[model samples]
Target: MLFGAGAGMLAGLACGGGSGDDARPAVLAHIGHDVAAPAFATLHERAGALVAALEPLCAGPDATTLAAAQAAWSEERDAWSRVLPFGFGPLPPELNALDFWPVRVDTVETAVAGAPAAADAGYLGGLGVSAKGMPALEYLLWGEDPGAALTAFQSEDGARRCGYARALAVDIEARTDALATAWASEYADALATAGTGSAAYPSLKAGVDEVINKSIDACLTMVKGKLDNPLGNLSGAAEDPSLMESRFSGRTRADLQANLAGVWAVYHGADLDAPAAGISVLVAALDPALDERVRAQYARTVEVLVAVPEPLTEALVADRTAVQLARDELDTFRRLLKLDVASTLGVTLALSDNDGD
Candidate 1:
């Protein structure tokens, strides 16, 4: 199932013929406009809402305001998860800024202690990645318990702590807004007109290759970075609950579910029944049987993930089998994309820095 083995098998398979070539422009257009653009828009909107919620809570640290802010953060986090498949364009540069995890509590606490009373964007800009993204905000909002988080906000350092959280939210909103604007104003054209005087891509094949390869990388991220690390698949030691994403809010399961949904959006479409021109169009045209298998495997993977109990930190200890089953299903999904679908599309798979065998 390694990519080296997949590349060897690809040498014997035929390239996706002229029809797939002809469909590239439409597919790119659909993905650019119908899929990526809207996803970023939602993320931007949700980030704005997060800022709004955080403002009132920072001004007055109360139970109701805290709940509202936490709910807003969850919504923004899910919106972000859905856009995880498209790692190109304006995403890569801002990825760490927007969602860096395994949050360093010491960094966040130190930053908060030294932050100005106002804690604006400039102050946040000077801080490191670990102290200012979604994870940091989750720690601030949820803490060890809702009561403790509220008590801290009402303590002598309450204003500084809340101000720092608000600053982080503001930074996230600005970044997401820039991402949405970039995709809509310029990057979409680069993708849609690829191979037709589009400087970003030399050929339609190259454009499609980027899309399929990113999808593969996203799957790999979910399988390894998100699931395997916490499950101790990489360390070959005891499961480490602290490695889980969204651990502070107990939303790790929701995050993984949203990630798989994002991958499915690329493989199928935004809609399953009436399908838009996602990579699925070219994939189905080039190899229908493989398409069906991918579709089925994706469903199986999501189903198993949903079955994993909530608060993935505890699940890693109590329900390790369910989590591992979900990971195995996701690995299979990644293999099908990296091996069969990429070969069918004649895509040149690019190596990702995070990729492992």
Candidate 2:
């Protein structure tokens, strides 16, 4: 039961071309080469820039240097967010190692205190995921207060704190570099050649299903984990700002937008009007109206999300209505992909680890 009764009826009427085997290879190639490879490369490049920016801040803690480092981190975060849809390849194993969120303040603080004066990769490798990655770095770079953050870097333990931050940046740089290399050198080909001798995907449907399932997972992450938890929609309790992601840096909204952008990239290809190849190609070929509906729904979701107030943490308490509106829109978008589009493709929906209320 991948679809509901209504969705099954829609599938029966819309899914005229069977499993869309003929259009899969082109879509896979477009996503692997054009969308994912470039995104990971940009992430790697931004990771390097983050390291470069942090070096100056670690050397001399100043307002200008700190701002530069924060900007660099934001760029890297955006790049990482845009690749959220491509959860296969080298990404799955390294996921937590790269961006574990709801960052534990105590864990990071302990690591900063215990770390060597000059923390390096070996030292960072011994630390837990809570003490490293983008979220941890966000805590280090932009703590509760901007002035206090700078003063802490200029205090007695400044060297150690800055050293730990540098080490985290290096760890991120290494991981992103490896991810980009793996995708460009090997995984891209494996995905593009799916069902035609690629061992990763035994059939064309497997590859397409992987893409669709990951997209659905991304949506679920936004609706349930990002929005619902923060809004306290999962529990019977009131809104909990602490549950919000990217709260330290106040970039939760940007992160959600980037997640949707990644999904859109998978659906519409690199460009919207003149797509090279995307899931839209297969869907439009089978049912043009469904494709149009998906496109419109995606646009509506983005629009509502943009209307929500910034610093999603505060919005969860003060502007809950706007936030809930955005969440509802995202759930609608999720249903379109999970039900209509998946059934139309004859794709068997797979359960992701993130799948839940």
Clashing pairs in 2: none
Badly placed stretches (over 4 Å) of model 2 are: 1-21, 353-357
Query: How well does each candidate superpose onto the true structure, as a TM-score?
Result: 0.93, 0.93
Clashes of 1: 0
Model 2: per-residue Cα lDDT over 1-357, one tens digit each:
345554444354343323434667888889889888998999999999999999899999999999999999999999999998888888988889888888999999999998989999888888888788999999899897657678888898998999899899999999999999999998888889887888898777778888898999889888998888878787778998777878878889999999999999999997766853788887886678999999899989999999988888888888999999999999999989998989888888987664552
The window of 10 residues in a row where model 1 has the poorest summed lDDT is: 11-20
Tell me the number of clashing residue pairs for each predicted model. Answer: 0, 0
TM accuracy, model 1:
0.93
